[model samples]
Target: MTALYPLFADLDGRPVLIVGGGAVAERKTRALLHCGAAVRVGAPRLTRTLRAWAAEGRLAHLAEPYHEGWLESAWLVIAATDDRALNARVKAAADARRILANVVDDPALSSFQVPAIVDRAPLTIAISSGGAAPVLARRLRERLEALFDPALGALARLAGDHRAAIRTACPDHGARRRFYDWLHDGPVLAQLRAGEPAAAERTLRARLDGAGEESPPAHRLDWIDPCPADPGQLTLHQLRLLNEADVLVHDAGVGEAVLSLARRDADRHLLDAGERKDPGTLRDKILARCAGRGNTVALISQPA
Candidate 1:
């Protein structure tokens, strides 16, 4: 399976088009509106909620058949109608205009794939299988939804509030990482969970004021000998490395199963068929990244 680069688009106040009026289209409209997209629905009729929203001036109602004019000023378009021909036409029009389009249940016609989302407000987790197995992706999202605490959203918000201070306190890459690790593994989350938010803020300030943690090597490169492709087979140390590595450089032999263990925010560099034969070039690129502002941990399948 080929890789699909995951992205989180900020649609605030951006124009977006929806080419249907049924329940599926309604769902899309609600999500788009939540992201502050200026939605325009191009359908002859709308569902109860859709019609109500249109009447309330929450969204514009075209009240006509789908046409190329609907694509005007749209950052992206979604066709959720059951009519296959209509969906195809919408997809073609979007393509001609160079706009991202998604035709419901038709991955072949879509320029973008919507993933199963776990909404934590500030911290959202999305899972997708490149539209090959949406059921599996949704199932995984269910598991994660159960695993993550909703308090995590509040925690993230708190961290966001202090992000600048934290950056200033720990300027070195290694120190910043250790500080974040402390934030995660230490008492900040616990204090919030325990309903002592003031205590949590104080704890964060105490650390930033000067906890004095020794910073490790600024350029430590680690290699994981390729384990079983199964993610479940990874050892504790390997799991830690996968999640912690800021810059991952993997060979073609690494499967997605292993690759998926890395954090979504990680900078991943996957070597293609041609790049595999040229390890030296890949190494130089990794070194250049490491030499930048912060420390970088590059993942390799074997000794370079």
Candidate 2:
């Protein structure tokens, strides 16, 4: 099996041609319409729902058999007809036009495969099996749907609303990341989930203005290894902390990819070999800075 690179396409107002008006085509059309695509369906016959849609002018109905010329204006094409020969012809025509096409139930003839999706408006999760084990992929999507709260969409919207202000207030990359982390896991999210959007917005504005709660006296210091070649190897907690750190004090040996995870505007201090030689001095220095600034400091080092 060929490895497929996963991607999300913006089909808004783009023409999509579906060669068939049967049940499969109807499903495809509904999905396309939900994404604001300009759908044009061609078939000798269509399902009652599809027929109704055509009558209502929701999509263009060819009311005839598929033709090669139909591929001309389409950004993407779908061959969902029951006839194998017709599907093959559709695939060939699409190939000649260098257009991306999917032949229903036939992965070998398809240039792309649609994955099972969990749509949360601005946030969508797509799970694919690379044209293998589709049912398993759907089951995984179901699990994810259950695990993720619907309120995430609201949270995303809230962030988007204040994005400019947040950027201006927290100019440093690290500080911005920390703000986002707090926004995601703090009381503001709880308020939003409780349907108190007004309260959430108020809290968000206050936090941005630095009028929020003071930091606790007991600060946390995370000793992390920055040698992982794959960023995926980092734990979710590690990833969150890296993104949320106010200060990142790292050994000189850390890789760029690991360091990149930290906020770009974060206060960075290099722990040279000589400084690292004195473990006691290094620990006191990190703690003293954290105490003085009341900022969260992350000490990144190789794992024992």
Candidate 3:
């Protein structure tokens, strides 16, 4: 199996070519449209919706069979045709041009695989199986959909609005991280969840100004047990915290799958039986390291 590096592409206003007009192509077109991508279809025939979009001048339609030059000026290409030879040709053309191509249902010929996405505007969560088990990835996406609140987008927008001010107030990276931790864990998130945006903003400002009630300490250790063997099995909250961690202290038995989810720059410390000889002493040592540093530590343990 080929190892793939996962990343999100910014397709806003970028030209994307779709080589089929079937349901699959239509689905891909809708997703592209959501991202504000400029879509161009090269199919001889299009789905009814695709035809409507073209008639409305939303996209360019070739109204002809696939050809070589269609790949020109395209940032990305999707081969969703039922014809194997045509899909192969599209893949080959995209490969020669170094353009990223996704051949629907044919991972072997494609350069990228589109993940099942949970869209919350600026906050999107994508789950992929590296073209190994798409259905499983979809199932995981569905599970996450229920866990993330739709109001998160509103909360994110609020944060974005105050980002400059927050950065100015908290010049230190660690201090900024603590402020965000407070924003997410304090009354601000609750107010937003309750649909009280004004109240949330008021609280956010108060906290930023240090006028609000004392926030929960940001420097603390989170002990996580029954750690997931597969990164895909981790809960959304776990994944978020892992990505936020400044330091990760884990037992030697912890799997790389879990560690890989942490921020790439996070400091890692492996704990052996010697370090575990006194649990309280180890906890104190970790806490001391975090003091005045605004560092958040994640202490992981294997399932007993």
Candidate 4:
């Protein structure tokens, strides 16, 4: 099953060895340095960028080809060398030593696959094709690049900051879920998307204040016809319906762009029926919440 993995922290001062000095190695080196890793480049030759980085003391470049012993103390390794045999050898060594290694264009020889990434400040998205469709993965990433408004990070930060308050105020699972739905569908998402963080926060706070201890529970709208006239268009009607949906249960083949349109505050429930949502338990929860709020709950299914 596909899943969202937890974010890994940067290796600021940790040692990471890059085995090559060609174009591929340069690209890998740049990414490592950007993430604040103390990089060491081992190659018989170096490119202009590599030479400059070494000159600036940003990376340690050894003018000798890679030796297997270099893996002894390194935390992570990247075998970007042109030699396929050497990359495989390095991958095997890294695996034996429990170190993470990525071999360029060689998924079978890699311990970990490096995803095509989108770094939007505080929000970083990593996309992988399981080593099957790299070009397609990158194309999809470019499309996503246009969809995520810059204000998303600011809005995410605001939500993160008041997490404690929201938790304390809305103790009941139902209440909390409702609040997030309101927050996402309300003006907060639009405000942030328009590059107004302070306005978004103010609007959210006001909504929170207006809500009562036993505020009206959220109502789920009926399943929206995924078939809008323009299949590629995001209709306002759809947005309104989604805003009120407390839990969005969706299936695979849902377009990433379409899913991205969901209210940021909505409690997303992936429809993994048998293995995840115990049918009886989910049904009971839905029924109880709907009863409390006098709201009709709806389930949306993607068109097959």
- Assess every candidate by TM-score: 0.74, 0.76, 0.77, 0.69
How well is each residue in 200-293 modelled by candidate 1, as lDDT tens digits? 9999999898945654555656667554567788889888877777777776667788888887766777756565456668657667756652
Q: Is candidate 1 or candidate 3 better by TM-score?
A: 3
Candidate 2, residue 143: the lDDT equals 98
Q: What is the lDDT for 275 in model 1?
A: 57
lDDT of 3 by residue, 89-177 (tens): 89999999999999996987789888899988788888888888989999999999999988788778999999999988777666777
The TM-score leader among the candidates is 3
Q: For each candidate, what is the lDDT?
A: 0.82, 0.82, 0.84, 0.73
Query: Which portions of model 4 miss their true places by more than 4 Å?
Result: 1-10, 218-304
* Candidate 3: residue pairs that collide: none
In model 3, how large is the Cα lDDT of residue 113? 83
Q: Which ten residues in a row have the lowest lDDT in candidate 4?
A: 295-304
Give the runs in model 1 whose Cα sits over 4 Å from its true position.
212-234, 238-304
lDDT (10s digit) by residue, model 4, range 1-304: 3443435657989999889899989988887888999899999999999999999999998888778888878899999999998988888889899998989859766766677778765678888877788888899999999988766677678888878778777766667777887776678989988877788889887866665656554454355544343335646766666555555555443444655555565455444545223544655555554454433323434443
Separately for all candidates shown, the number of backbone clashes (residues 3 or more apart, or on different chains) is 0, 1, 0, 0
Off by over 4 Å in 3: 211-291, 294-304
Clashing pairs in 1: none
Q: Sort by TM-score, best first: what order?
A: 3, 2, 1, 4
